[model samples]
Target chain A: MTAVESSVATLDPEEARRLRRERLERIGSWVLPLAIMVLAIWLWDRICVWNEIPQYILPRPGVVLQTLYNDAALLFGSLLVTLRITFLGLLLAVVGGVGLAVLFAQSKWVEMSFFPFAIVLQVTPIVAIFPLINIYVDNQTAKLLLCAWIVAFFPILSNTTLGLNSVDRNLRDLFRLNGATRWQELWHLRLPAAMPYFLGGLKIAGGLSLIGAVVAEFVAGASGQSSGLASRIIEAGYRLNAPRLFAALILISLAGIVIFLVLSLVSHLILRRWHESALKQER
Target chain B: MVPSTTVPGMEGSGKPLLSLRAVGKTFSNGVTALSNVDMTIREGDFLSLLGPSGCGKSTALRIIAGLTAPTTGTLDWSRKPGEESSVGFVFQEPTLLPWASVFDNVWLPLRLKGVSRSDAAPAVSQLLERVHLSGFENAVPRELSGGMKMRVSIARALVTKPRVLLMDEPFAALDEITRFKLNNDLLELWQDERFTVVFVTHSVFESVFLSNRIVVMAARPGRVFQEVEVDAPYPRDEAFRTSPAYAALCRQASDVLVSAINSTHGAAA
Candidate 1:
């Protein structure tokens, strides 16, 4: 505290003012959002009270919280199922995306011959392909996982391909000058350069994978013990259990938020020291 | 120093470290980047290829560095039997890997040659020390200022201890003060290491300041125009930069460069 005080005291008036602004910004970034959320939640409760809405139609936030507590085992288990598919799908996408991107980086013929297929797959909606998957894949879990992978794969493939192609010209020449082999060039030059791009895709893919899982389960309509939160939401909707439906939805959104945060953290940890995207914000 | 009295074109140094014999390059687009760029670089010679922008000095350097192939003629290197074909090249920009640390960047050549990081540490550290980047081994390229990045690049280039060090206007982007400081440090390293240098640039003052021999090149087919020797003794400093002898040499080189530029301009017109 003394060290900070001494530094502040040493700063000029303008510098002190700037320092104060920085402190305020740091605190406000967290506190402001929380305050607004509290206000919004209060407003929601007031509307529920004023409308005198019944529990089935528009359950109060308190009732939803109680239902979440009451249905913890069911809701949490369903979230785990959804999260498992999302993660497995993302893992497959990374391996396939990066592997194929490397192939594309190496040979124009390979890329030219098959890149259109990837484009077509990306452009074709997963919903449109659901019927096809259902026909071929008898396993419900595999079907949902495949749908998630398809949704998540394109961003990783395209971003990684772009990054691989964008290797610095001079650095490439340097690698060539040093007699680096094809494998060495890919491992040392292309992969590290593609990391930021790959991570960017990962962040987008994280959320998309969750959405894919939920949407796929909804489309599949396979209800059972192993069914994900999407099935629970559908079941609660059928029973007119608005609080339970809200609880299931809240679980899915929370799971999505956790996945995004984890992916973002992974990106930050990998690139914090070097990448421009992860560098300390001067502003 | 090769006594500053050696003839520009006369043969029989027996071991001209590298000699370009009628080198020419024509791109697929039909732009003749270089033609008949004949020159011989001797051991420990600070030779500069000086001219205007389109003069193909960089192309000639690249050809010598074996980055680009010459469509016509040969680059002959008279290496000793045990010597590997090696040359260090510095690009116009500080092309250190943005993702790699200063030490790792310097360790690259050794790493490419199959040396492990721990094994190459001694050489990397020694070169980093030579370039005054000793404490900055862990810093990435983005963390460095432009001049410092250029310094790291020089260290990386020299880490392999190549027989020839080829620089393509390595300090062109730096401010004048930083450029001068780097010039001094480079000369110090040259004096210490005694490696042959082939520096390419358009600035006559810089060329004259650094090189004992400056080969002025012409554009529009980029060929050698003239060769001017500095005839100045080493241990050159600010005293030398302000001296009448240096002024005369700069004037002579500048006149040659202006003539080369005008000739290219006339051809283009």
Candidate 2:
């Protein structure tokens, strides 16, 4: 083929190097935060008097680690409960969000009619409604769903709406020229093009669902007979068990971080092939 | 005695295949893009629409391709009996789907007709080979160079064996050497495929090198200003581009363009 025919074979090395440099810069910037975290953990252990502070009032990180080791069964059991609630809540949010997005995208009237309510739901604090929901819903899991849906629904709805609407004019025309039916256009073109945006929204919503689960559990004041990490945390705080309280807090943070990282990793894995945004440095 | 079964534009004999009737286009903002344009696009002919920027050359080609309906007038296609497909279009930009493989992009037209990949593989592969992208089937559009992408676009246009191929400045973006080489390959493809080509370009020499007829246009109420016949033989090469006939035609086209520009200036003044 002539050079015109083979034009797509060339790559810009400069652009590739710039992409590499950007990734390295990102890695470089994270080092300071890592260093500070390590230093702070070391100092907290060294300065705090482990024996002087009562066992219930203030346990050292070492002590919390020991407590974590000792109460692995209880901790793991509570963790499973919280995780179930989070997972179910997130799944429900995705279903609700995608359904609403399709409705809104298909018709401007529906988007206008239902959009204000979504905004209102988004703006209204989840913490305030937790008690009301908890009272109405005897099932703790149902209350957890309500809270998580409130937190997670907006991103999915907003992102999907944007994604569906952001189709290229040329691409739309191409579909038209090809005699593609409306359903074909939607399924083949709009959905695939919107995948990156949907994944982004999903990543944000994953963490939000976890937060919702924890907050709902907190307000419910669930008893340890069938309780979660949030109940244990509240119980520890009320009884002045400082190290255990910190230990519970650490568990919650770890859960949030793990959910966040997992979703981010999933988004990258799904989008890294075709999407420019998800592309990483070769190194 | 002739069989009379040969398609008008497909054989080496030159003849008009399509005609435009006082076609005009005006944007909603009241900008008249094309005004009272008249042209006959002949078969086995390389008709170049040559003009400066915003001359409505691209708009005219789009109108013919049925991509956009003209604000006024009708396009008449003198179809042969029982011909199923008629027109193919290549835009100024490559416009290949970045996500699709080279082979898939070329096979898009056939696929749209409900043809299976296996069924259309021979035609797709042959078209690819014609465009000189022999072994690059699995390569994505982004992986290819700019010129290579345009070739894929060309192959995509030709895959269905169109009667009329409309191109809007297909090589205007490339460097001089690349453009020159593409110009040569395009001529060869046209000779082989035997399809009528309406190529839009702004370069005077380019129009002279490639076209059987050059339709010169002027912007600001875009309209046909002049038409020049090249009267050159097929399989035109670099040698043909450097010949006296080519230089003379280029000068004639350039003069017509200059006069068109002067007339517009005079009217504006």
lDDT of 2 by residue, B1-269 (tens): 11122233333436668888899999999999999998887667778898888889989987887778999988888877887535788877887766678998898878877789999999999999999999999998777888899999999888888888888888989988888888889988887778888999988998888877788898888988877766666667878878898787778889988977776778641
DockQ, cand. 1: 0.74
**Which candidate leads in lDDT?**
1
Worst 10 residues of 2 chain B by lDDT: B1-10
RMSD of 2: 7.0
- Per-residue lDDT over A27-61 for candidate 2, one digit per residue giving the tens place of the 0 to 100 score: 97898789899898887776667447566765667
Q: Please state the error at residue A283 of candidate 1 in Å.
A: 5.5
Highest TM-score among the candidates is held by which one? 1
Give the least accurate 10-residue stretch of model 1 chain B, judged by summed lDDT. Answer: B6-15
By summed lDDT, the worst window of 10 consecutive residues in model 2 chain A runs over A4-13
Against the native chain B, each candidate's TM-score is 0.93, 0.92
lDDT of 2: 0.82
The DockQ figures for the candidates are: 0.74, 0.28
